[model samples]
Target: MSAEKTPGISAIDTTNFARQIVLDFEFAPVPKQRQRRGLRNEIIEVGAVKLDYHGNVMGEFSQFVQTEYTEGVAYPVRELTGISAVDTAMAGPLYVVIKRLSDWIGRYSAQVVCWSGADRRQLLTECQAKHIDPAAFPTDWADLQTFYTSIMDVGSHGCVSLSDAATWFGIEFDESTGHAHSALADARVTAKLLKQVMDGDYRVSPRAQEIRQRWGGWASEPRRAFPRSAPS
Candidate 1:
């Protein structure tokens, strides 16, 4: 088979494949300085696709969490994500959305997957600020971008956007899934990439473990379901 047609990794490798739930997060945009300082990029949306070991999507989740920022939705964020103050006017608060997310996660024994370390860090930051139970979050995570780069012989630090990765790997991204910033659509696309990358064997990168440690790894905690938040 041509290199383009060959699956680089084995689909059945338990180390690489688990019941995996690919995740993507879109946060309320803050100024570049604030974002770099980890000052205020609140997660406005959460999206995920639950996949079986064989890469079949089993389920999906999406939520638009309301923000508490007083200035209202920033225009840049709205322009980029297509999420406006009006869009999230009736959405649940972050805690409520997180509660629902935890419930959804309980249905599967799956590892959380995302494009990079940013989403995991954002989750940790948000959870820590709210005093939300970390146990509610997925413990295991794998960065698909790092994995993709590694397998494709690109340097570990290569800059590959989601669209670029999909194009490189021959994965089809559905444009009708809405804009790139929509979390659920991004999650579905990431899951598709995961399926492609997992078709061959690759070792887990140190970045995965680093992300796990930053979030305090995994711990079991009692589940608490919040009554969905009311419109602000």
Candidate 2:
């Protein structure tokens, strides 16, 4: 189903979906040679949280996938995500991991929600590279970042990072939930933000207010980003 915008708030209508799988992926850039050959990044990890319309947790999934980079993950990737090559060495292949994730999704018709559209594009690119049908996995996807921006009434280019968004919502990232860059941690934070938006409990933090001012918008009251309505 397509998302409809709320009249004044310009937020997306998300009540039509049965469930949402908040997903995230950690990637390592391919070797220069592969990049020359048109390959970009490799999926090193996958993490997701399944949530019902009201934002109740239904299940969770996390997987590390073996990548072609045997030498090890790049220094930057390692530093950002703390995911070393050793962590993925014992993991299964990409297709296998994807299949397992699909199985975990089960028979429920759900929408895959990502912090941004990047994950969806990365998944499709990897599937194409492996000659795997992208349709084998849930293709119905939503970009939570877009919805978040709309809810905040920020300019298109004024979208904030996931960590920043979390901070705006007063969500603290600590050792318990890993850190900002970890795939599962990011997914969990995104899920939390989604719940806050759905419940109309989101507030524009000082930082978010700066963003709104810089991006040219007046401060507005916090409103539900996604309004619940009767199913079509």
Which residue pairs show backbone clashes in model 2?
Answer: none
Error of 2 at 42 (Å): 0.6
Clash-forming residue pairs, model 1 = 8-200, 9-199, 9-200, 9-201, 10-200, 10-201
80-128: candidate 2 lDDT, tens digit per residue: 9999888888888788899999999887777788887788778877877
User: Mind giving the per-residue lDDT tens digits that candidate 1 earns over 134-184?
Assistant: 776667666666555444433333545786556544444567455677899
Task: Tell me model 2's lDDT, rounded to 2 decimals.
Answer: 0.74
Candidate 2, which segments miss by more than 4 Å at Cα?
1-13, 153-157, 205-226, 230-232
lDDT against true structure, model 1: 0.64
Q: Return the TM-score for each candidate structure.
A: 0.72, 0.83
Best by TM-score: 2
Alpha-carbon error at 78 in model 2, in Å? 0.4
Backbone clash total for model 2 is: 0
